[model samples]
Target chain A: MNPLRWLVGRFPTLALARRNLSRATLRSALAITAVVIGVVAIGAIGTGGEAFKQDQLEAYEGFGGTATVEPDVQFEDGNLTNTELSDGDIDRIRQAAGSATVLPVHEPAGSFVQTQSGTLLFRARVKGLENPGEFYEARNGTMPDNWRRTIVIGARIADQNDLEPGDRLRVNVTDEFDRSFEIAAVLKPQGFSAPLGADRTVFVPASEFESGGYEQAIVRVDTTTGSVDAATQAIEREFNAREQLVRVEQVQEQREQFTEFFGTVNQFLIGVGAISLLVAAVTIANTMLMAAIERESEIGVLRAYGYPKRAVVSLLVAESTILGVVGAAIGAPLALGIGMAINQLLLGDPFAFTAAGLRYVGIGVGFGVVTALVAGLYPAWKAANKRPVEALD
Target chain B: MAPEPNEDDGRWQEAGDHATSETIPTDAIIRGTDVVKEYETGGQIVRALKGVDFGIAPADFVAVVGPSGSGKSTLLNLLGLLDVATSGDVRLRGRDVSTFTDRERTRKRKETIGFVFQSFYLIPTLTALENVEMPRMLDRTPTKTRQRARQLLERVGLGDRLDHYPDELSGGQKQRVAIARSLINDPDIVLADEPTGNLDRDTGDRILELFDELRRDENVAVVTVTHDDYVAEAADRVVTLIDGRIRETESRRANFEEGPDP
Candidate 1:
């Protein structure tokens, strides 16, 4: 015997319920299809959200241990006092941020850069850092340990000007400083989530500028050891001990904000999906009611043959539950297939799945069955409780 | 097993084994004492049965016969424990049925009485064998129920039609299936309402013969509420009702040991 038949045969109520559902194949199939659509809606959206989140988190990998500290402009008597972080502040930050690398930054006033060939002049960001090797990787040449008159330009800026190492470019800072410097290296392009717009910035030696105070400071640490968190807390404490002196923000916080925002969106979408499922529940209830009404005389005969009201109720509920189970069984896999396709298209890995994805699918299936049970209850009770004579007549 | 009495004697008698003993037998499977059944239709009290006395013993073939608007179906419902009497008590196996709780009454009805209706009432989704096994499905083991259902169908001479759906079977075959279903639980009494009313004369006669065989062989009391004169005449006793009261009770047999074979 088929396992389902064997199982149904083992229980009379299940056998009867199955037989009743099979009597109207189209209505049952339509009811089940409604449930399937509802399940797929919830599962696929949740799965797609998780995949997008995973993709973002992966993009944020390289910037995990980095944080930025800038002067928190203090407004007293309607005047800005603390506009930039001073050297004393940098020393205090280094002292507080234990075991984390700190680099003070300078912004030079350079309008545009003309290549050594003098072919074209384009605007570019001018950043002065003491050691470019600590923060950036060289794609074409090398970043030196000892910094002098050498410069590193972002790959985009180098490509735009057709510049390479050993080539010299003039910095248009002021009329007094019109000297050209040798190109040390061309820096690789930073990822989308990388801070500082590193892909388009021009890097020069900090010693070349007579800096009094810096605009920003970069803090780098090993994130796995809780060093990033420790450094952020220490820097915040040191700068804002009495009053706000500087603002400290970690790159991971932005990623977390994105995650939280998507979490809310996912829940809202699931709620919408749940509403569709409830609609399916209503359809299931109607189908069950129709079945009960159509089989009123049959139910009367069962009752007259000594079947209790509870037996009749259970039989009807069992049929509705069967409809839900079968629908969810099909819908879960279909949702999984869609999710995998989405993951493969978006993240290039079909198997890139998360617990949340599975959980959503599980929840969809669970709700499908629960809605069916809830839907069946009213019709089952009404049908079973009808007077035998009334039903028979 | 007790030997079946000779069933060929024709005599003017008072139905069942109690007639020879001169009083209603205390061992009667079911009894009604002035059972009065009423219905309130549109604020008017419509009495379906008015203080009628009736009883049936084991192995008795009793037919309730009456004209339309007489209380035959109402009394049948009360006797079958399918409904309650308005003012009197209907007893099952000498116990007052009104005193039993709802569940207990249902259980008693299930275990003690079988029913065969005019339309056969077979579930269309179920095969003939499944319909036969329906009553015993809950209380009996599946294997035991199936085995007995098979035996009953074979006894009813529809052994080859077990797997057929109700629609697939003819009117006579469906009635046979219903008869087999009625015996599946081995109830003490089988109450049939218009059992042969839907069948042709030839098929109805065969159904009557099947009822006779069931009553004699199974030792079950058969009470049939019907309008067919042939059914009334074939029964061992006939209870005729008029205007919600029992007008007369006629017997065709003196006791269980004497009756005519089909």
Candidate 2:
């Protein structure tokens, strides 16, 4: 047959396939549901992992050219213990970091602080910064001087304590030593910083901190003279020269590590999801086999009417392809919606919709159709090879 | 085996004589010579048609009647090209079909033969018109097939039931629709296997009358396989089969016109 005639002949077979599929609606629906679940599993995982990687990159960018120096000790669960940097090390970092501002930081364990009303008390961590103005902006008042007994509190602390710049709060250094300190300022809400959460911390002068050594030092690179990479390398050289076992990391490096980790995790998730799709393939094969068996006499009639074996095979495969396409049509969008909901719940925003994520929708649909076609092969072969006499009987 | 017929018997010659001849007799639409069919069930060979010879002529109504397991359906299947004979040649328009490829055989069946089954095998999902259009669709004739289908249905007295499904029609109506389907492709021969077996006596008579009308008006060869005595009585010729062989051949119509000369 000519190509055009062959193409036209497929119309009736496709129509017959569609009609037969509709005749057995429940079985068709079960097969479609299986494909839907498979597509959704891969799609949602792909989109969710992408959104998480984006959120981490954005958070890292918010730190703004600041590199942190801490003791080379592993911290557990956001808490640092015995991670003290000596004064000599701090002075050396300050000298080596070219044309940059260095701020010493100290965070003691959390202490209990009574509100101005004296009726409520809360446990809060007190962080000491050498130059608080360079790191944080004041939402209400100016930063404290070098040796003053005043403190700058975070927005959450100010809100909970109902304190302004002039309010006096008693600070308890130990069980027997307690002193009243004036609130010099309230810092603006900064969501999260490199080493700690800034929204709920209380900032004080490093001079007023009773600890003899600092916890970490922040180096603010001067973009006018050198880039953050150059300053990081210079600081690393200083630490290497001193034979100190300090770890230096650029914020971008940290972001890349995070992205690589999530990439592996996403691949694993997609692999797990593909297993469900394998089950769906089996479900499609079973459905097609049953349909071929049930329609044995009908197939015989078709053969008697001069339908070739290829036409019969095409008809059965077309039925499965329709199932797969319809399932994907419903599943791809559902996966996106589920991914968005998960993003909003976990990352606090619906940022999961990306171009790459949309591509996953297409990939999921392709996967479904290919799986259905492959699964339909055996049944189609069986249907086509049936002898008309035996099938009619 | 029966002795070969002489020329005075008024039957066409055996298929071997026409091995090099390009032209067939004008009247004979399909002819089967020394055709054999066998089946193997659990390692035992069952010969259904043991060297049966048969021929159908255009514009002739021929009924093949037999008891159960007499190989009447088996001979019909071979003549209709639905099954291949194991030994001898079945010829369509004087050409041996044993040499035809699978595709060519299917195309020949689609273009030259039509069939009506006893159960009225109209596709249930399609309406009467669509059921008749199926063979033309298989032929891949894209133009005016539906119009021809509708006209065939109307000719079969189903003009008012064009859109009715098989399940919605009576047994007689479904059979009429099947007859219309059998004629949709304008084939040279129509093969019916117990076309009236599922109908009442009155309905079966009506269907047989329709077949007679098709043979007279369309001049298409109509062959039926049945055990009904009424069907045999209605045909112009009745060939009786007993135990895989033709036992008797009887002519009912005394005066029949010979078709145009080849």
Candidate 3:
């Protein structure tokens, strides 16, 4: 006897079994729909949450470096600028750690820039003076040479004060010093910077900062030289013996935190999906149970013809698996569509739906088949055990 | 042990030379020695068959007749291997079949026995040809079960009704399909539990005639359970059962086409 032929021979009975299940079409459809909803929900929520978190991380990447170094131990509200690395300390760190580039920065005193229309208060963060674009580029004009009393205003600040690329403005430095500066350019608003408030800030050269001002040192490590972790550990060991407040940020730390946060949020989505899948499992089980009971006579007839008990069970399981496969096949794309729709509506960005969701769909279908098989166990056994005479009667 | 033949009984000893090659030599086509069957209902145990002894030879058409509660149906189920005897042994073709499991019984039944239920238990969803092919499906017999089923239907005078479902067919047609199904496996014994019980008188007589033709021409053993004497008279031998015991056994040569036998 051909194994293939045997399987084919049994195919008709399976088809008949599916037809028997269709007698209760509404109940079976409800079970399939439950599976569909679970898969779709998981896909949409899980993918959407991941995209949102990535956007959040990307917005913060403009913080000048892959990692930052600060005082390892500092009391809250204490002045970090006084204890952190200064210009000379930054030069030493850069020379000491050959592979890393450290940029020293300071926050100058807050002052008001007055335009023809109004006056707006803006705090200035100072970085190394260079071909100023090397420090922080502007949207319109070039950086001024020789500290020609030129300033690059923020877009919001420029809008508020009606400042332009060639306009001259008065920069009053805590009233101790005052200077008139040319507005070299306007910078696009970088979302929330830690030291500077939202849009109420500006950037200037570091050479102008006086003594006893607050400042920070940002380090960018080259990953090709060595492990970020090894570099951080070496830096900590070198700085540990000194009185200086020296802290380091390993780029790996940020990546790890990103993964941890994403994992936690994805777990939550999976939990929600699992609960719905469990409900789908129950629905599948209930549907199979009802079908098994309703077709008791039909099952008995098959058994009388010498069909094995295993075959009866297989038929029921196969029908449920087919339904689940069909549902998941349709639901997967629906889930992607839902994710795209949500991304566009909520974040103003279209997201990608990956094929990784196939793993989840396969799990859902497998669960449906096993649940149906388990549910039909007792009924299938009863049908197989029925005495032919009793069944006929 | 073979029991001595009673006087005046056609023992097959003197007429042994009449045995044709087509006739199955059933020294014990169906043999039950002191068989017993008990049924428990509502906490009361009722004995349905009580220490009964009987054997049906191959090519012999026999009838078991009794009142409704006299265990005729129970005896039919036992012979068909659909039910087990509580005590004693049943040997089919000299093999002790009493100890067989349900699966084994199904196998043996498919190999050598067939059944026709009084209710015409054709699968309601299947057409007449499909219904007839159902029994043959058990053996995986090649050569197109569907075509053989069609031939069976044609033989039963329902060639045009092959596609009709059980519900669509008349009562007579359904019984004919049931008869066709019983012959599909070409079993040695056809155990029919009141084949004509649900039909009108004329149809019932026609079905009996069909049974007679199958027994004489195909050389198949037939055990029919019926409550009507007219139906019993159509058989070559009749055994009367009362309260689950064999009360009497009688032999009559059925001159069926000519007239009723004495």
Candidate 4:
């Protein structure tokens, strides 16, 4: 018979498979649970990884422009000792990338501020910028108009220190210098960005940087002039001519690197999950073989009743496929639940349902069913190849 | 008896008062000629059936009796199309089935023959009605098969136990379900291989009576392989086999009128 007609003729076999699998509920359940674990692993990891990548991309995009020029720091045993960027380096970068906006920043290391009541002291990251308005918006007060002993704290730091506009805060720089600065403003909260510490940062005027020159320069490329890559290359060339040790990092490049790294990690996780599925496949095959052995007499009886070899094979394959489908039906939703749980508990974001994640669910299910079918092939063949007389005997 | 017919040419006519006319009838359900079956085990060739010639007509209840190794089951398997002979031809309705392909043999088996095993091989998971409907379902007959299955179960006095699985049924009830399943497709021949081997004497007798009724009512050829003398005594004809060859054939004038000699 043709394949379509053959499939149509297998209704009774499918029904018989259902009955048989139900009869051995514990064994079948264990097999299905194995499939469920494999599917959930693949799906949960896939969705979680994609959601994290998306979050990273959004955070990078929120940091303003794509490119940044920073000093190549000298590290001794993985601890940063000093930076090499100077004001001359920033000027040369601005000259070479004429169409780009350069915002010079001075970051004082190991600095903190205290509330006027002396109730709290936070170890803070002090960001001294020439144009702070370009990066932060006011949450409670206006930005400082004069370069003096005035400060703007991030929303979280402001809330923690209980200092709003016009509040005097004692600033301790490097555990030695102590100065009192008026809280000029509080900036709105921006989530984690690698280039800028937004939520916990304390911003001050660049003129207050008493120790050194600019530490880093943020370069915003005018898209109408050239591509971001072109501007980055121009700035890198200018820095390269001035100093041997300089690192020009772009937000887009960092995003791509993060994506590539996570993609590899996701692939490794999927491979591990596939190993579990391989174990599941072996379990299914072993179970089917045992079942075929136990049901030899029944198979003989069926053959005596004129069920062809193909029908017998179809019945077995249908049974395993049903197990796979049922397991996937349970596991797919379980994976989504796991993804959501990870989002809520670990990443602290709502569950993201991307098209790629949904497609991975589909892949997971298809993998399960196809694994079952492939694993069932040998057992089905063994069942079908039994001679009726011998099996009856 | 008359020298085993040369070709099983489908021209044999019953010679009793049940014969309606002098002309031959085309109802020669099973015909085996010079059938030989061999088995090889542990580097030894054991001949199961040497050269057996057998045939059964419609409405005939023939009992095959033999010792343990007399190849009675082998002959039954050959006639039922469950196994092919190593040599010779077994025909169904005058067609040589030895040359049939696997698909053709399966088709013919489903349409023409039914088998009843000693163990009452009912699928343990299925209800009695479902077991009986197995053959019809295998044939892919869509509708009316279930009704026919129910009717057959009722005919076998299992109407009330139709919904019960094999485990829920008694030994006799399971056997009755098997018999009902055998007749669900209305096959031309019913091959019973020691159908009462596992039953008690009274239950065996009742099963024999049921077989007799089926033979009389449906005009089906019932060929049973049995060691029980009572079963042999109840048949219209008895064929005795010894060491893979038939030794004697006895025709009884009255069915079950004279039981086996004590």
| Reproduced native contacts, each prediction | 0.55, 0.45, 0.21, 0.66
Candidate scoring better on DockQ of 2 and 4: 4
Candidate 2 lDDT, A75-102, residue by residue in tens: 6789954478888888888888868888
The segments of candidate 3 whose C-alpha lies over 4 angstroms from its true place after superposition are A1-10, A34-65, A74-244, A264-281, A308-357, A370-375, B1-26, B138-143, B227-230, B250-262
Q: State the interface C-alpha RMSD of candidate 3.
A: 3.4
- How many Å off is the CA of A389 in candidate 3? 3.3
The residue ranges of model 2 lying beyond 4 angstroms of the native Cα positions read: A1-10, A71-84, A98-211, A214-216, A220-226, A242-244, A342-352, B1-27, B138-143, B254-262
Best by TM-score: 2
| For model 3 chain A, the run of ten residues with the poorest summed lDDT | A123-132
CAPRI-style docking class of model 1 based on DockQ: acceptable
The residue pairs found clashing in candidate 4 are none
Which structure among the candidates has the greatest DockQ? 1
Once fitted onto the true fold, the runs of candidate 4 whose alpha carbons sit more than 4 angstroms away are A1-10, A70-83, A92-193, A196-216, A220-247, A343-351, B1-27, B254-262
**Candidate 1 lDDT over residue span A2-67, tens digit each:** 776466567878778888999999999999999999999999888987887787677677789989
Measure candidate 3: CA RMSD: 8.9
What TM-score, computed on C-alpha atoms, does each candidate reach? Answer: 0.77, 0.79, 0.69, 0.78
**Tens-digit per-residue lDDT, A20-92, candidate 3:** 5566678877877977876676666666665555544554555434456665546666553435465566666
Model 1, stretches more than 4 Å misplaced? A1-9, A74-243, A256-262, B1-27, B255-259
Residue B195 of model 2: what lDDT? Answer: 85
Query: Chain A in model 2: its TM-score?
Result: 0.72
Docking class of 2: acceptable
Clashing pairs in 2: none
